[model samples]
Every structure is written in structure tokens, then in C-alpha cells.
Target: MSIRLDLARDSGLTLSDALSVLLPTPAQDLSDLPRTTELVQPFKPFHDHFAAQGFSSVDASDAPCGDVILFVPRAKAQARALVHHACQRASGKIVVDGVKTDGIDSLLKEVRKRVPVEGPISKAHGKIFWFAADADAFSDWALSDMTLAGGYRTVPGVFSSDGIDPASELLIAAMPDRPGARIADLGAGWGYLSSRLLEREGVHSIDLVEADHVALDCARHNISDPRARFHWADALNWAAPEPLDTVVMNPPFHTSRAADPALGRGFIAAAARSLAPSGQLWMVANRHLPYEAALEAHFTRFEELGGDARFKIFNATRPRRRAGAS
Candidate 1:
């Protein structure tokens, strides 16, 4: 295996960003290789980018013995476990790749503490590090002993896994009482809100739209309603096939490499577009976000239902239409 680091001149931007432009095609080939079983986590876009190339992917599952795993660790603990798993089962060399902005360099240093690396270290926006390992050494680093907390067990790289997100909690509290409505949860990370909505007696159909394949995988397992549908979409570009009665979202606020407040702004615009003329939009967001102005601009009636110092929930409804007109 080979390792390379792509260093970025801009301290604010990750080398991964540079590499994205420099090596899009070749990187595609590398990520597309067929594997028996692959584990991708902690990052959604990378996993989906790889999955698009046709690899059998698993999100945050234990690496099957003899299976070739594509691992992306969101935390130190998960990185260690995947390294351990790879060493034990890998018939080929161990391959570990990460973006410098994501702290792949630090992770590599940690991995080196356990097993020595034995290949060319390559650098770009970050680095790709690989080494050989024996099954015993790998198994020693494995962590099956870790337990769940608050009924949610997360290995690593999941969105806000330590506990329930306050924003989601707020959104759930403010969810419409109307039953049998078609609902879509945009950026439904782990399906926390979506799953709760599914349990609602009033929900008729639910679509969980997550851009990251890894998050969607977790969502599928987390939400099992037959009415649940999953869409891997760039939420910025996704359009609903049909107008929806209710659109519930805790839209993501950031896009990689920049603080694109407009990311969520676009989601808001799309939600407004997707809703029926009389449908409602319930969304939760950080308190400081300048969304009230946007909400007012899009909807005929809007209200701030609940909030505290850190977060706020907005309820916006489209204008009721008058009798038959052009």
C-alpha cells in the first residue's frame, strides 16, 4: 500500500479540497475498487462517493473476517477499532486514507503507535497512510466492549451521537398533530426525528433524505417503517416528486470548506416549494441564524413556537388559496 499527504497552502481550507480538484478521476478509480465487505463511517459524502463507484458498503458494522473493509473513522476509538479489524482480516495490505482537515495526520500518528507503517507516505490535502498488520495485533485493538448510552449505541462518526440533539428534540416537540400526512425529513441524520415521526399515528408516509450514504444506512436500520423511504440526494438540488403536506427539517447549515449559511437557506426555499399551498413547514435551527426574515419572505404566515438561548423552532405555513383562479 502507498500513503500520500496533500498539503493545502490555505490554512483555513483542507488539503482534501485541493486533492478533490487535482485528483478527481484517479481518486474515483481508487475508491471504486470491488471489495467483499466495506465499512464506511463518520463521513457521509466520502462514503456515498465511494458507493457510487460500486462497492459493497456497510456503515459502522464490525468488519467481517476475510472481508475487505473501506473504513472512515469519525473518532479516535473507531479509528483504532477499524485499524485492528483491518489488520486481522485483511488478506492484502492495510489501506487508510483521510483528509488532513479531518485530522488524518493525527490519526496516522496514533496508528503508528500500535503497528509500524511500511510503505510510501503520500501527501496532498492530507495523507494516505497504509501498513501491514497481523490478525492478533489487529484483534487486540478491537473494541466490542464499549456499550450504548441513552438507548443509542454509536461506534463513531455519527452525527451528535453522545445524546439527542437539542434542535431535533425541539423539532419533535413542535411536530404537527395532524395524522396521515406525507412527510420528508431532510438531512435526516440517523433518523432520530424521522423515526419519531414514523411512530406518530398520523404519519402516512415518510421520506428520509440524507446525502451521506453512511447516515442513510444508519437511518434505514434506525427507522424500519414500511412507509419509510430513503433518498441519497444533494439536498441543495433534490426536488420532491410530488408536493408534500408537511415538510420537517433540521437542515444542515454548513457545506464543506466554507460556512455556507445558504446551504440551509436553499433547503428552506426547497421546503417552501415542496409544500402544498396550504401545507406547513416546521424547522429548528440555531438561535443566531437569520432565518426569520427568510421565513417571512417565503411563507404567508409564520410563528416562532419555542426556543431558548441556543435554539429556536419556526412554524411557517403557505398562504391559503382562494376559490378557483388562474
Candidate 2:
């Protein structure tokens, strides 16, 4: 990894400065750090880095802090909670790092407001900020009150945290009927689509697949259908244990800093793979995305179900045989 020393020096530093400087060292030195622990949230890129470090892992919510490292949530509010949580449980320093787009600056401000600490913060293409605090005094912000939407309280920084997404609204409006069978909502955000789908007749069970664990937690709480199941799995990489009768999604178009139309296209292909031979797929995306070709490539019949200038809903039915099956 390229060192953004210029930016790092500007942000402020504590134990995080030494660790960031030593990030490229041999794995043995990293693992050898006595009482070192690493934590990361649902973001794929962040998780990949933490995993590459080969640090012992734990679910962000349940991970405990001793005299160890702590990965805070990417969101500003959750990041604050993580700092407090670490301080509450551990006697040593806590290391918090995240990208700028995730709001590291705001997180630093929030942390300062809650507990005064002089730490290292760096800003460049993005930013990283880390501080040290007592785990015993660390707060559990998730347990605290937060603003709500559609009856769900968000910790901040999760996608579509403010309100229902207009694209999803269009997609949900175009959902087709599938009675008394298995259904899956890919990229399920706060259980909106699945919740609406369950209201239809003949819907037996719905699996809500969301990549962000916090989003999944809010979704599980938002929609209380006994048949609804939530899984924190990547949409492109995960396969269903059993084929789904219907797959509905508003798959993410961007992987990180830039828009990746391929990611959305990949979801189209993955949706096809996750379905039974005749299972139907319904999706909505921005009008600019060139997804029709991908949809047609994967499913036998692909057509625009609905849309406006900004978004379009597409319905594609899986083919009984492969392309050109004879």
C-alpha cells in the first residue's frame, strides 16, 4: 500500500501512527504484536485489508476489546460508539481507521465531543484517524438512541439511511407475484422490498440478503414476518443453499470510490445463477446503466417492466436451458 504520509501526518496520530507506518512489515511482526486485535465493518474493501493482515477476527458487534486493537464502524456515529466500546472494555489504546468518504473527520469530531483525546488523523485521497482510550469507559453507541426512518433507527453512514431510495421504490412497484414459495431479496436494504413482497398472496418465505451487518440488523427489526430470513452475504459472491423461486434486487452499481457498472451486471448474472431454471428475476437500476444486454444474456426473456427518466425496472425469467441449448 502506498503511504499517504503527507496526509497521515496532518490527521493526528497515536498508536495508529506506528501501526500505519509498519503496515507493510512481515505478517509475523504484525501477528506477534502481543494483545493485538483487529475489527472491521461490512465494507468489502475494509474487510479485505483486515483479513489480509491475518489478524484474529470477530463480528464488529460482538468483538471484545482487551489490551488490543479495535476496528470501528465506518459510519460517524458507529465509529464513536466503537471508540467508547473499546475504551470501556480495554485498558490499553484503541486503534480506529477508516476512509474519508466514510467520514473520518466527522468521526474525529464526534469522538472529541464524547471524550477529549489528542490522536493522529491523516487526509489525502481519503483519511485515517486513530486514538487511544480506556476500554472500560468506551461507550456502546448502538445501544443509544438514534434518529429513525420507516420505524428503523440507523447508526449513520449505512446506505439509504435517511429515507426510502427512489430507485428501490420504483423496483418494488414492479415486483411480480409468486405465491406460496421461496423468494429472495438481493441487496435487501432495511427490509423494504421483502416487507412489501410479503404482503402479496402465496409468498411463503423470503430471504433478505444484505452485505452490511448493521443494515441487516435494522432490516430484521423493521420487517417482522416470521417467514423472513436475513443473511449478511455479498450479493455477487454468495449462492443460495436452495434455489430461489424469485430474486429481486437493486444491486449496487459501485464497488468503492467509482461507479462500477460491472458490479451491477455481475449481480444480474449472479441472480440468474441463484435461481431455479424457471425462477424469475426482477430488478431496478438507473437509466444510464447498460444492463439490458447483461439481463438478456443471462435470462431467456428480458423486458423493461417500468421506469421513469432516472430509473427503469427490468424483469427477466431464467432459461430452462443454457444459451443455445439444443
Candidate 3:
């Protein structure tokens, strides 16, 4: 929570055509983080926020920037990758800022080992540090595909990048072993369910729709099958190519630091809209969230299939069909 305005006041670094990585929306009544011509954020919902805020975004690897301001993410691999890439590509000082909760101190220490570290203004439960771009150092951190548990191809910072999410596993276990239906895995991360769906006896086809391009890229690698279609679009906005026979997912529950039930609710509505009359949905959510209202509104039938202490799976059938239908 280091006040970005302080970074401008304290740091001697010049900012022009700057690049912002995993940058958040500037707080209201605030001024003075470097102006970024390009933003590198993989999360789809945040992309909407950045665009609305008038920040031009470009891909992290290819963006040509004079300076960089990195809002360090929680994942060590992702943070390190951004730091290394920015350090290599930017022409000016690279400023790193993040809360201690987000591993700012560790990043500062590791960064000090790699380059000349400078004024780290500590404020608002976070640290803001800077260093001159050393294109030669941190060669080890260049982006490379890494393997996670269960042989899943994951880039750093993708949801559950370190391992298979237990909630997803529960959904997988409860999934129909013989889903003869054409399916859609909304918010499919790394194609875990899509790959598993292919393992079933009668799964006709699976459309893996995920918003994060990095995660979708890993999905492509994980489930490289002609039967598996891919869509890199927001789950809430993407409609199935055709009405689906079945939908299975663990809809994402949050976009930022705050819990967003609206995100999951939007997924439910999308599922209902894209399902055929006889189609069914198998979804998992946290036990306490209030998705029942949405499910009831969109589907003619809804039932809780099973649950554990942390997660619950549901089965909803016979989509209610929006106003005009065949």
C-alpha cells in the first residue's frame, strides 16, 4: 500500500513512456505514479478496468518502454519474471512496489542481489524500491514454461499455478464419468477439466473458455486436441459457439483483493444462456456464496450434488431460455 504519489516525490528516476506491470487502478484523489503507455496485465477483468482508466496496454514480452513500474504480484515466479523482463527491456530505472503481504521485501532482497538497489520508501504497509535496468543480470528469470503438479503446464501467476486446486479436483471427482454431451468448461484454467473431459468415454467435444491468455496458452499445450476448442475471452461475456449439452466449471470467485460474487453470478447466467433445453450444468463454488439465487433464476431445475467443508458442487438442468427462443 505504498502511496504511489510518494514514489514520484522521493525517487530521482525519470518517467516517460513507462511500462506498468500488474498495475492496479490508481486510487481516487491520488497522483504521481509514472505515466505508462503500455500495461501488462493478464487478468481479464482488470484489463477492463485499465482500458476504462485510459491506459494503453501491450504484451509484457514485446513492449518497448523507457521506464517500468511494477506492482509486484503474489507469485514469486511471476514477480521475478516481470522484474527480469522489465529490467532487460526498459531504457530507464525500474521501480518495484508492493505490500509486504505480496512479498515486496523478499523481492527487494533478491533484486538487490541482482542489481544496484535504491531508495525504498516505506509507507502504507508496503515498500517502494528502484534500480537501474541491468540487461545482463537476472538471465535466469527469463520466462520459460514450467511444469506443475499432475504435469499441468502453468505459467507463473495463473490461478492455482503451483498445483491442482482441491476444489477443482472435487468438481472433477463429482463430474459424470461418461458425459456423452458436448461440453463447455467456463473459466477453464490450464485446461485441467478439458483434458480430463477428453479422458471420459463419451465426451463429444469440450470448449475451454478462459480469459487469461497466459493460462489459455498453457491450456493449449495441456490439451492439444482437435476436439477441444479454445476461446480467450471473458467468461461472463463469451457465449458458446453453439448451445452446449453440458457445462462444467469452478467459476472464479474474485477479480481483485475483494470477493466478487458478481463474477461467479455472471458465469452462471452465461451457462444458462448457452445451454440447450435439455442441457445441464455442473458447477462448484464456495459453500457459503449465494449463487442459488442466480441458478434458480436461470435454470428450471437446480440441485446441490455434493459438498465438503470448503466447496460445493451443483447440478442444474433445463435452461429457462431467454425471452426469444426457437
lDDT of 1 by residue, 1-326 (tens): 11242221122212111011111222334442334334343344555565676644434444334323233444666567667766655555565666667667787777677777644245656565556546766566675432234354343545665567888987898775663378878888778887778777778888788876656766777767798998877665577777788888888786454566776777777778777787888889888778876776677789999877888988888733222110
Candidate 3 Cα misplacement greater than 4 A, ranges: 9-11, 18-36, 52-54, 321-326
Model 2 lDDT per residue over 41-100, tens place: 464434545567765333353434443343333456656665555555554455554556
State candidate 1's TM-score: 0.70
Higher-ranked by lDDT: 1 or 3 = 3
Q: What is the lDDT of residue 261 in candidate 3?
A: 95
Q: lDDT per residue, candidate 3, 133-185, as tens digits?
A: 88878889887777977688988888988788888889889877787568999
In model 2, which range of ten residues has the least summed lDDT? 19-28
Off by over 4 Å in 1: 1-74, 85-90, 95-101, 118-128, 140-153, 319-326
Q: Model 3 residue 20 lDDT?
A: 51
Q: CA lDDT of 128 in candidate 2?
A: 48
Overlapping backbone residue pairs in candidate 1 total 18
RMSD of 3: 3.1
Q: Estimate each model's TM-score.
A: 0.70, 0.77, 0.88
The per-residue C-alpha lDDT of model 1 at residue 195 equals: 75
- Global lDDT of model 2: 0.65
